[model samples]
Target chain A: MSGGLTLVVALPLLAALILILLSRLERRKGAIAGPGFFQRNGVAVGLYLAVAVGFWAFFIIVLPQLAMVDLSFRPKLPPSQMGGPKDIFTLENYRYFLFGSTTSTANWNWLHIKAFFLSIGVSILITLLNLAICYPLAFHMAQSAPVARLRVLLLLLIIPYWVNEILRAFAFRVLLSSGGVVNKLLMGGGLLDAPIDFLGNDVGLYMGLSYAYLLMMIFPLYNAIESLDRNQIEAARDLGAPWWHIHAFVVMPHAKPGIASGCTLVFMLSAGALAAPLVLGGPRTLWFTPIVYDRFYQAFNWPQGAAYALILLFACIVFVLAVLRMFRLSLGEIAR
Target chain B: MAAAVELEGVNVTFGDFVAVRDANLTIEPGEFFSFLGPSGCGKTTLLRTISAFIEPTRGTVRIGGRDMKGIGPNKRPTALIFQNLALFPMMTVAENIGYGLRVRGVPRHERDEKVKNLLIQIALPEHGHKLVSELSGGQRQRVAIARALAVEPSVLLLDEPLSALDLKLRQHMRAELRAIQKRVGITFIYITHDQGEALTMSDRIAVMNAGVIEQVGNGRSVYAEPRTPFVASFVGENNAIRGRITQAANGTATLDTPIGPLTGRNPVGLPAGDEALIFVRPEALKLGGDPPSGFEGEALDVTYEGSITHVTMRVRTGQKITLSLGGGAAGILPQPGDMLKVGFEPQDGLLLARPERS
Candidate 1:
C-alpha cells in the first residue's frame, strides 16, 4: 500500500515486541520509563507505555502523510491519478462527517457514507444489548447465589470458553438458519404461520453476534462481581437496605469496571465483526470491516482500504482507552 | 423473671458427627455468659445454635420463656457479629451503624439520630461520615459493634470477634467489648477458645468439650472446684497427681500411694473404690524444709519464670509433682536432685473423677 499504511500497522507491532523484550531486561536498559520499567518484570506496564507511545508516534507519521480525497461531487468514481500531485495533508475527508459542506463529489461516495453510519449504529446496538443481558447475569452469577450453587455454575461458564470461540459462533449459525431448530420449533409449535427469514437477517445477526461475544462480556463482569466483598451486601442488609437497595447502592458501584469492560468488549467486537454478522446478516449488512475487505481484496484499492481500516482501528483504541480512563485502569491496572 | 436463654438437652449432629450433644444451661438476662473451649470443642456450635444459625437436632432452645422452634437467624431477637466481622465495605461508618434500623423501616431522620448516638456510644462520634475502608482495624471493630447494637436486639452474639487483632490490640478490645456489654446491659453470649479471655470477662463460663458441657459455673467456681478432670486440666493450669483412695470421710480423703498417704479434699460423688485424680493448683504447693504431717519429697528441678519459680519434685512413691512458687519467697531455691520436703493444705488439693472418653 502506502508508507503511511505500512507504518500504522508495523509501528505498534514493533513497539510491543520491543517492550516485551525490555521486560526481560535488567534495570540498566533505557527502552521505556528507564529505571521505572526496566527494574521490574512489569511486562504489562512496558506494553502499555509502549502501545500508547507507539500509537501516538504512528499517528504523527500517518496523519500528515496520508491522502484525504473529497468525493462530494457528481462523479462516484475514484480517480487513478490521486495522492500524487496534490498535498498529502488534507482535513476534507474528516470535515464531511464533522461539518457537512457544499462540495462536488468525484469519488466512491455511497460506500464511505454507508460504512461510516453502519459501524456507528452496530457498535451502539451491540454495547447496549451486551449491557442489558450480561449485567444482572453477572451480578446474579456473582452475588445472588449461595456459595455452593455458584461454584457449579461457574464451572459451566468456564467450560464453553475452553471449547473455543469460532466453534461457538458457527453453532449459533446452525441454530438460526431457515430450517434450523429455532425456525422448525416456531413452525412446529404454531408460533409462526410459516418459516420466515431466520438466517441472513438482523435477527440472525443479533442472535449470533451476542451469543459469540457474551462470554467476553460475562467473564470480566463475573470477576468484578466476584471480587466484591459480601460484607458490603451484609452491611447493606444491616443498614436496613432492602435487597434492591443493596444492589443499587453497594453492588453496582463496585461493578463499574465490569460494566465498562463489557460495553467496551461488545462495542469493539461488533464494530468490526466479520464472521457472525457476515454469516448471519448476509449481503445487506455491509459492516465497515467488509467494506475495507472489498477494497483490499476485490477492487485492489489497498491505500483507500488501509485508510478506512485505520479509522476503524483508531476508533476502537479511543473507545477502549476512554473506558479504561473512566475506570482509572492504566495499562498495568487492566492486566490480568 | 424469665431467663434470657435456656438451652435444654440441645444436641446438634452433623450426620454421624456430633457437634454439640446434650448441652443444658440457663443464661439469666444481662449476664455476660461465655462458652469457652479449645478449637473444635463445639462451643461455637452452641453459640450458633443460640443465634439460630444452626437448628438443634434435639432438645429445646428457649428465649423469653418461648420455645425457639423454627426461628431463623433474622427472626430471632439476636444480633450475631460474625467471626470475620462482616461489615459492609461499600458503606460509610454511619450507614453501617444504622443498617439494622434502616432494615426495620426506621425513617432516615430517626436512623441518623440513632446512628449518631451509637457513634458516640462507640467512642467515635466524628467517624460517621467516613468510609469503613478508611477506618483502622480497631475502628472497623467498633463499627461492627455499633451496627449490631443499632438493631437493639435483646441478645448480642459475638463469634470470636477479637480473634483477628494482634495480641496487644486483642487485650485492649477485650476490655472494650466487656465495657460496652456492661453499658448496654444486654445478655451477651460470647464464644471464644481463649481461657484467659473467658475468665476475665465472663460472668459465667461454660467449659465444653466433644459436644458436651464438661462444667458450667462462675469463672472462680469452674477454676477452683472443677468437678471433672477435664474441667480441672482444661480451665486452667493444674498439676495432676494420680493416687488411689485409702481413707475417705466427710470433706477429707487420704489417698494411699507410693508418695505416702496424700491428703486431698473430697469432691462430691467420688466413691471410695473409684480411681480418682488429685488436682493441686501450682501456687498452693509449698516447698521448703519439713513437709506437712505425712509428706516427704526430693526436689527434681526448679525453673524460674520471672514471676514464679516452677518446682518439680519427686515424693516417696517415685511420682513427680510440680508446684509454682512466688519469686519473692524467702527460702533456699530448690535445685535438681536436691532432697527436700513439699506439702499442701487439703483445700488446695481436689480429687477428680476420671475423664469420660473425651
Candidate 2:
C-alpha cells in the first residue's frame, strides 16, 4: 500500500520535471547539440541539483505527511484483523475528536478542545510579547550600538541558545521553583513579601517559551532594520517627528516582512512545543500536544493521534495564511 | 520667515580625532551659504552641529538670536536633506512630504492640502500619490526637498545631495535648488565636495580642510583671492611650485624656484627667506605670451572639452603644468613630446606660506 502511494505521488512529479526540461530544451533547440552546450556547464549542474532536491523533499517530507494523512482516515484494529471487515475506512477516529467516544455520547470533548484553543491563544500572546521585547533590542543592535559592542551583544544573545532547548526549559523550571534563586533574590531585595508560586501558576511555562523563541524573533527583525538607511531616521527627526512617530511611520513599516516572518515562526513553534510544556507546565496548565502524545503512545491509537495532529497542522496553516494576508506579504518575501 | 544661524567656537571630536575644530561662522538670514570641502574635511560635522544632530564638544549654536544649547534635532528650526535623500519608501510622495504636519497633529485634510501645495511647488504635482521608490532620481530629490520644506524650517541643510545623480540632472537640480531657496526665502546651508556647485549656487562659500575653516568669502573672491595654501590648492586646479621667498614687499613677493625666480601676489606677506608656495590656476597660464614668469615644457597630452581645451606639459623642473585655452583661441594644438612655452602674470599667481608637514 505504501509502495502504491509513493508511485501515485511520484508519477505526477516526474512528469512535471520532464515537461519543464522539454520546454527548456525547446528554447535552446540547436544549442543542445552544439559545442557551446558542453562548454556551458551551468545547465547540467542545475538539472542535477533540482533532481537531488526533489528526490529528498519527496521521500523525506511529502511521503511521511501523506502517510499520516492517509492513516488519519483508517480504523484502528489488531494486525490479525487488518484485512477484515472491521478494518475498513471510517470517520470514527475524527468523530472521537469532536465527541468523547466512538459510540454516540452526544457530548463534546470540551477538555481537549479547550486545551487546543488555550494552546493557540497562549502562543499568540507569547508571539506579541516576544515582538515587544525584541523590537527595541534589535533596533539598538542594528543601528545605534557601536560595532564592537554589537558583536559582544550578538555573542551574548547566541551563547545562551547553544544549550539544548529541553535542557534550557528544565533550567527554567529550577529557576522558577518556589525555593529558586529568582524568588530568593526578590525576597532578599525586599521587592516581594514571599516566594511567588511561579511553577504552580504557569508563569514558568510562559517564561520558558518566550526565552526559547527570542532569538528567532530578534535575528529577522535585526536583519530587516539593519538594511534601513540611518538617514531615513534622521530625516524623520529633522522633519520634527518624535521617536515614536519615526518608528510608526518609517521603521515599523519597513520591517513588516521581518515582523510577519518572526511572529509566524514563534507562534508555530510555541503551539507545537512539547518540551517546554512538559518541563514547566503547572498542574492546572493543560496543553493539547500532550493529549496527542497520549493518544499515540499511552493508548496505542495511531489513527486518533494522526487525526489530532492533522487538526493542529490545519490550524497552523490557517494562522500562517491569516498572518500573510494581514501583513500583505507574499510567501517568497518571508522566505528571504 | 528665515533666521540667522551662528556657530561660535564650535568643535567636534570623536575620541582623539578632531572632526571640526573651533568653527566660527554667522550665516545670514535668507542667504544661500555652503560648506565646501573634500571628504573627511569636517564639513558634514559642522553642518550636523548647526542642525543639532551632533552637539559641539565645546561652543554654542544660536538660531534666530536664541541659544540652542539643549535643543534636539526635532525641536530645531532646521531640516536636513541627506546625501541619499532618505525618502520613506513605504509612504507615498504626499505622505512623505506631509509627515511633519501629521506628527504635529494637523488634521488629515489640512495635511493633504499642504502636501498638495508642496508637490506643486516642487513641480511634482502628479507624483504625490506615487510611492517614493516609483519616482525617478530627480523626482525623489524633489520629494525630499518638499518633505523638508513642509515644516517651513528657517534653515535647510543639504549634505552632498546631488552627488548621486548624473551630471545633467545634478546641474539641473543645482539651478532648481537655487531657485527654490530663493523663492522660499530661507537660509540654505549646502555641503559638497564639488567646488562648482558652491561657486555657482552659493552667496558665500566656506572652504574647509583638516578640521579647520581655511577661508570664507563670496565665490569670486574665494576663487581669485584665497587666503591659505590649502584654500588655493582645494578650490581649483592649480600648478603648485615650492620655493623660498626671495623678496617680499607691498603684498607681492618673489619666489626663487628650480626654474627661475617667480613673483606673485603674497597675500599673507611672508618675509624674505621664508619658504613659500605659489599657485597659478590652469586658466591663468598663457600658452605663448610675454609674462613676468615663464617656463618651457614638452607637451604630454592635450584634451579638448567643448568650450575649453586643456594642454598638459612637463616643465624643465619635471613638474606637470596645465594650461587652458579658450575655444575661440586660434592655435595649433600641441601633441606629445612637443616643446611649448607657458607663462602667467604676477597678479594671476598666488603666493602663500607652505603648509607644515602633518
Best by lDDT: 2
Interface RMSD of each: 3.3, 0.6
Q: What tens digits encode model 2's per-residue C-alpha lDDT throughout A52-168? A: 656666777777898899888988988898778887778888888878775655689887888999999999999999999999999999999999999999999999989999899
Which pairs in model 2 have colliding backbones?
none
Question: Chain A TM-score of each model, in the order shown?
Answer: 0.67, 0.89
Which portions of model 1 show Cα errors greater than 4 Å?
A1-83, A95-155, A158-167, A190-192, A196-201, A225-246, A249-259, A282-336, B59-62, B65-72, B257-260, B289-307, B312-321, B356-358
lDDT of 2: 0.89
Tens-digit lDDT string for candidate 1 (B55-165): 899999998788999976656778878788887765789987887786688999988999999999888999999998899888889999999999888888888988898
Least well predicted 10-residue stretch by lDDT in candidate 2 chain B? B326-335
What candidate 2 gets wrong by more than 4 Å, as runs, is: A1-44, A102-106, A184-195, B1-3, B305-307, B332-336
